[model samples]
Target: MKSTINTSQLITLPDGRSLEYIEYGDCSGTPVLYNHGMPGSAFEAQVLNDVFKDNGLRVICPNRPGIGRSSSLSEYSLSQITQDCFFLLESLAFNKVTVIGWSSGGVPSLWQAKHSHTQISQVILLSSYSHFAELDQAPSHFAGQASVLKQVTTRFPALGLLACKMAGYLLKYMPSLYFKLLMQHCHTPDSDIIEAHPHYRDMLIEAQKQSISQSASTLFMDLLIQFREWPFYLKSIECPVTVFQGDRDPFVPERIGQHLADCLPNAQYHLLPGQGHMYWFEKSFQYRLARLCQI
Candidate 1:
């Protein structure tokens, strides 16, 4: 399927950076900004294209700095990331918006809520982790891959970057094999969902290619920052927020979601019995979100 993004809509930032974003759904509908996960790009929005369109929602998915066509940032911080998003929204003539984050994408969504509560109508996190520091006690199987990377990156930055390069290269150049291995690591619920809906797998592969093709370092940078301590606290966010977690998620434990829900000043936690990390890609996701939006 053709992408919903218009190249003509690309905007230049004050720092000479480019903000590449794609629009989906009704042109005159309510606005929502989707913050994609690590190793993702604006193309990630394609997975939810039909959902947004049917709901009469205007969705904007942007490629973060160092990903896709956007310029790389020398320094990375959650605060700066939120500010950049604010600038992009303002430039697009949008003020109030619903922000949705998935996986690692939750970092920015939470930061945006903390920094610009008045501008954000609501915040939603899908299979997200609260922070890396607090994940010490999470499942060892889930932390194993990340822990190795964090350790290597802390000890040898060059080697860490090379590892990321190799991983991204495999993802972009050898996607079929890469995804096969990736599926092996997923929980049963997520694997079943992907196996049933082959198109969803294609979407993930394409998003990875789009992101890595632009900058292999982008994923590495995201990982480095993800392991460090976050600048803000979950309790600081006063906006209406909801966290959707899957009981079978292997990447992020259910306990993390429950803890975050407990911490957020105003947040609700919804747990799905047999779902997993990729539940957001399911067709029924739109209806679930619609029901929540009505509340």
Candidate 2:
């Protein structure tokens, strides 16, 4: 399938905030809301443009506040972000949508499923973080700078903000080194996949660049929110959810996905063997998505 790269469009919210978003695939096709990962932006959706177009899926990927061209908020909750998404859907006249949340985006996606169950048809979480408390319980299970960053961000936010700023600087000025450092702790498959696919690597680099294009403060707050306790219970989400996790993922443990699936009343967990965090870019994922949408 040919790739489609649509320019971002902006929508002004009732609260006077501008939310920037990118659309992919057929305009009149099946509606989908894609929640990008942390250090990611709407551009992340471009990686899957071919799959979306092939499956006749209309994907609406929005940049969270403080990312991309969206208006930054001093104080915002996951619920507010979810509302922003719903408002965008309303403006687009999309009454129902399938939500796909990757990494940190899963929190707000779950919020959407819980709060707006009527409008949400289904949800898919890819290598997503479950809960901060869950991680705290088994600190040893997760390792590397990501774990340390979470701990620092939870206890010393000021330091965390500084760290995020440094990361943003690296992403903006020294992306090559930034990615090199990032892949240092990644599983072998993850590194190999990135090295093999230049498009995928470029997509990720661009997403990270856009993520901190405005400021790193929002990124810090995003991390803080993820570290703190979530407001909703997993069991409260009535919509069917499918959780995908790579067993070799270094950042998010496979058991976390299982635990999340166990909590949800209607959720299925799929563990991908010999896969890593970047497994979503594989053909298997595209096939799964096509099957799920019954295309």
Candidate 3:
């Protein structure tokens, strides 16, 4: 499959901030708005390009503010970010579309589903974060680390900013080392999946590299926002929602997914056995995409 990396386009929002995005797969097919992960960019969607093409689906993947070439915001909320996404959709004349959020991307995706239920046809969350209230119930290691980071960042914003900058530097300069360190936290299945697919590894590395190509301020802001209390209620989302969680995912354990599903009024929970956080890179994800296409 051809790389979608070079197909990125830019649009100027009403506030004069530039938003960078990429459109891949069947352009005229069913539109799907993809909200990439926190430390991700439009390139994250490259891994699903083949599935998107085979399923005749169009993907609109955008880089959040301060990531890639998108203009950074000194102050922004999830609601404001959601508005940016909708503004792009409105500019494209896409009145209704399926929304998919992976990891931290799920926060804004949930906001989109809640704030604009009339325009959202379906919502899919992949190993997404639920409310901060559920953090205590998550895996101890993941929850503890998250809690510490949130506390540290809250108490010392400069330290957090420094850490984000260091991470960005590592991603840009020593991506292999960065990937190696990142995989240390992954389950065996996630590492095995990446080892088995060299292309997927490359895609992930490229995505990470692009994520902070501009700066690391976005990463810092993303974590800060995620750690804070979400402004909306899950029960407010009345649209059909699907939550896919890997039983072996270390970052977002199955319990977190279950909690998110239980909170949503109309959500179906799917627990994939033996899968990890990066399960989307596995072949099974294509089958899931095919089934979603039938909806």
- Output the number of the lDDT-best candidate: 2
lDDT by residue (tens digit), candidate 3, 1-295? 3333338899999999999999877776778899998688888887777777667778899888887788888786787798999999999999889998998888888889988946789999999888775554445424424456777777799999999899899888888898888899888999998889878777877787777777777788888887777766788889999999988887777777887888899999999999888888766786686568558
TM-score of each: 0.89, 0.93, 0.92
Candidate 3 has its poorest 10 consecutive residues by lDDT at 137-146
lDDT of 1 by residue, 1-295 (tens): 2224334257788888777788876667678888988777777777766666667677888878877777778885566677789998898789789999888888788878888946788999997757666565445424434456667876688998997798787896788898988888798989888888888888888887876776778787776777777766677788989999888877776877877787788998999998878988777887687555534
Whole-model lDDT per candidate: 0.77, 0.83, 0.82
* Regions of model 2 farther than 4 Å from truth: 1-5, 134-147
Residue pairs with colliding backbones in model 3 are none
Order of models, best lDDT first: 2, 3, 1
Could you tell me the TM-score of candidate 2? 0.93
User: TM-score winner among the candidates?
Assistant: 2
Query: After superposition, which runs of candidate 3 have C-alpha atoms over 4 Å from their true positions?
Result: 1-6, 134-148
RMSD of each: 3.1, 2.2, 2.6
